[model samples]
Target chain A: MSSEIDIKYVADLARLDLSAEQAEKLQQELGRVVEYIAELGEVDVTGVEPTAHAAQLTNVWRQDEAKSSFPREVMLANAPGIVHGDLIKVPRVLPSEEE
Target chain B: MDLKKSTIHALSRNLKDGVFSSEELCREYLKNIDNRDSEIGAFLEIDRENMLNAAKAADIRRQNGQALGDFDGIPIAVKDNICVRGERCSCASKLLEPVKSPYDATAVELLKKQGFIPFGRLNMDEFAMGSSCENSAFKQTKNPLDTSRVPGGSSGGSAACIAADFAPAALGSDTGGSIRQPAAFCGVVGVKPTYGRVSRYGLVAFASSLDQIGPLCNDAEDAGIILDAISGFDPHDSTTLPDPAGGYADAARKGAASGSLTGLKFGLPKEYFSGGLSDAVAKVMDETIAKIKALGGEIVEVSLPHTKYAVAVYYIIATAEASANLARFDGIRYGSRQEANGLVDTYYKSRGAGFGDEVKRRILLGTYVLSSGYYDAYYLRAQRVRTLISRDFEEAFKQCDLLLTPVTPQVAFKFNEKSDSLQMYLSDIFTIALNLSGHCGISIPAGIDEATKMPVAAQLMAPALGEKVMLEAAAAFMK
Candidate 1:
């Protein structure tokens, strides 16, 4: 079973802020899922390479030429905040001390 | 003319023969949606005026003797996860409630190239996380066949629309049986082409390696037509294979016309027919096998030994990819946003509020599995086992042209029937392996479950890019 601290750590890594209640609830639920998935340990996978993709695809490259993209106005249409009629504005990135 | 019951090919023939204009067909479908959609809740958004205008354009083109193709005027529903320009591409989540797509997905673009109208955005499980459409932050899409039960999901609304006759056909993405399971439940034909057979450029990412876009239609021939229209290599999606020859529709037609499966060999995996299958579904399977034998197809017992481990590997790999793919929705770029004192807090609050319980649980599981120290034991191990599971298919196909199995252990359950997450995950046991192996699979309605009277379906899985033979067999089975 996942401890509360473990669940908190996972939530933090996922960038999800869970309340005490949510974390506690998730701990139990995730514990069950993990336990069920633990059955994979029984399979002996000696020297077998992992299959990351269903279809084998190597490096795919496209021409590095400028082409049409979504217009500036259209691209930023869904932005929560916009500045200077183009730039997407977000909250401060750096800490107060860095600023 | 019962437009709802008619197939896309039949409707196209009617349009060509001047039985009715494309505008008339659109109005009939619109009226059907108007009268029935409120109860079925299959559509998330429908633009009647836009649809009619497109239909009028189709009519004008026909009058000018420049019809695009057979499907020129066909109205099709698109699963919400697929982008349709200028329409709400919510994926049935509050996070994308305010977001509208700026461009059509590659599949939608292809459909438009064939003069097909993108009629409406259908609902799905938020980010395609849940087995049932109940995870939608919006309304729950009930089974059109039985309003009290679920429409099997995350492509629930896609399947529901076809079943309810709201559209002649629809497009749905399958990561872990999202298309086939719902198609089985709704008693329609659904196909999940081999991974990379269709471009995933515009599909909202959900397990990138496993995700595929395919069609849900009235029959195997319609599936062939839609697949031909939407499939081809795209520079946009690097994973897509170069366009194969365009004979899938012809293959289906030939198979249906042949009236015999004389030389076909079908494998029945003993693992699939074993325990945990409900008696009702098993009885249906026996009858289906008998029917297949009568059709002159030979049945052979084959073994996919690692079948039991599919669900475990699928959840790990799918969730791990989902955690990374979904990280892009951090509030600043698009979709619904929540403000906070700092950027970190902004991400936390927005994601926490935006994601539903099922999505949150998966993110947490994904994060836990992929985190440092546990990566080798969990994610890497699951990948290796995924390799073994895939190899199982590779070996099984050598013995037969295709394999037949039940799509789900049983028919669609009542709403909230299996609330436990593991139980819900286990329902996908048979279907997930195909996604993991990167093979194509189709689900066609086999018969009705005598006990519940819900739809029961049988699935046929083929080797990678084996769509031609698979569709032929499916068309034969349909006949």
Candidate 2:
């Protein structure tokens, strides 16, 4: 197994950015950690079930009726930017036409 | 009364008997925080007026014969990650420095229903990702016992505050030994309840599967009181056990008061004793086991063959879950945002600027494991190994009532002693397996290390939803 990760790609997928220095630093550190955890390869897990989480229940349901919830304004209060008084605002997804 | 030496049980009785008004208790805690907190750095934020008002309201309610209950008016400081409605829930990260929870977590709501005031925001590692509080984006919380050393984290502030008597009890969430390790380092009691035992409605998710909110306090009975207030079935959290709750208080009291473990079998996992513990911790463990034997308990050696893999399994699973959970912190929503030309750039910039080094490292690792081709190799393999690890505990419990081990390999060390991330992660070996296996565990102070002179604690764990037996044995061990 190669510890040489395309950290830049992983970082991009995780919605993160790294400077040249940070990327180099993380490349080595991530290498060390990944190598350390490679010990798991030694454990033979044939026919063992995988657990996504500790939850044993399949799905939770409630009455399909509406109930009182936190006010929309309150929910949006923490939004970094808001467009309409109630809507969360964000940077545009597409590039400029000129570009 | 020396407020610093008081316990929750004693404080509750005093509040009832009017030995000190709830207002006076709050004042004492504030004074302690004002005087001692500069050195300890345990608290991140306090709504002073709100705390005082709550204390006064409790006093007025008592005067009107409407006192909430035994824990009413008693203040419980909160971990920053668990939301408290109007208070900032930073998770001690720069990214979340400005976010406030919109509502109380179910555990906080239950505590409030019991009249326990959510007093202040306690510090923790950035998103509860590190073993040392140094990863906190805000401040480094030191061990109150030895200023030169650390309060083990990511629940470092919770443990430090309790140890310093800044708060009688505190609520902390444990994913990978966050609560138990710190409680052990600070020489107080910490409980990590079985997964899903407490509702996770508003807890800032770390590793959703492994995280469970529990208490940090002076003793087993107090831990029980806090647990009783917090643990229950919740309609919102489907994972919660559908069993009836409450009665934890008496479980602990009966354990301590009975002073007899006559028929109980205490298992000592042979793996926990080998190769890792310092002499101080080893001595403390020996003494703790001797005391358990003296209390008429039978000792059995148990094998958890996969113990060696707990840290690896935990890192993969925990980081993967964390990667998914923390992805919610993209700059478009709550928390600190660094805007860029495009939405994706904004997310990258905000996260890059907001998260600390350790948190980023984990997100990257998590992303790698869960990435396309590697997913089956790392994440799936880890989950499969997690099943094996959980089975090890299930098998061990069939042989004994509960298992005992050291909380950490050694006592608290100086800040930066564990600068290496892998070493820090490895230190959680003893306590991490508990979270992985869905069992409940507690760390009770066994003794102070003669060498480090820092506190050493013994960990007692029970199989899933086994708080009663574990707390009982913990109570027995404490006595």
Which lDDT tens digits does candidate 1 get at residues B211-326? 99999989888999988888888999999987574578888998899867889999999999998988878988999999999999999999999999999999999999999998
lDDT (Cα, tens digit) per residue for candidate 1, span A1-99:
232328988888999978889888888888888988988989999999999998788887888999988898998999999988889999987788855
What digit string (tens of lDDT, one per residue) describes model 2 on residues A1-99?
Answer: 887899989998998889999999999999999998888999899999997767577767777997999889888888888987788898889998988
Tell me the DockQ of each model, to 2 decimals.
Answer: 0.79, 0.81
Candidate 2 chain B, poorest ten consecutive residues by summed lDDT? B1-10
lDDT of 2 at B415: 88
Give the poorly placed runs of model 1, Cα more than 4 Å off: A1-5, A95-99, B243-245
Candidate 2 CAPRI assessment class = high
| TM-scores computed on chain B for all candidates | 0.99, 0.99
Q: Model 1 in CAPRI terms: which quality?
A: medium
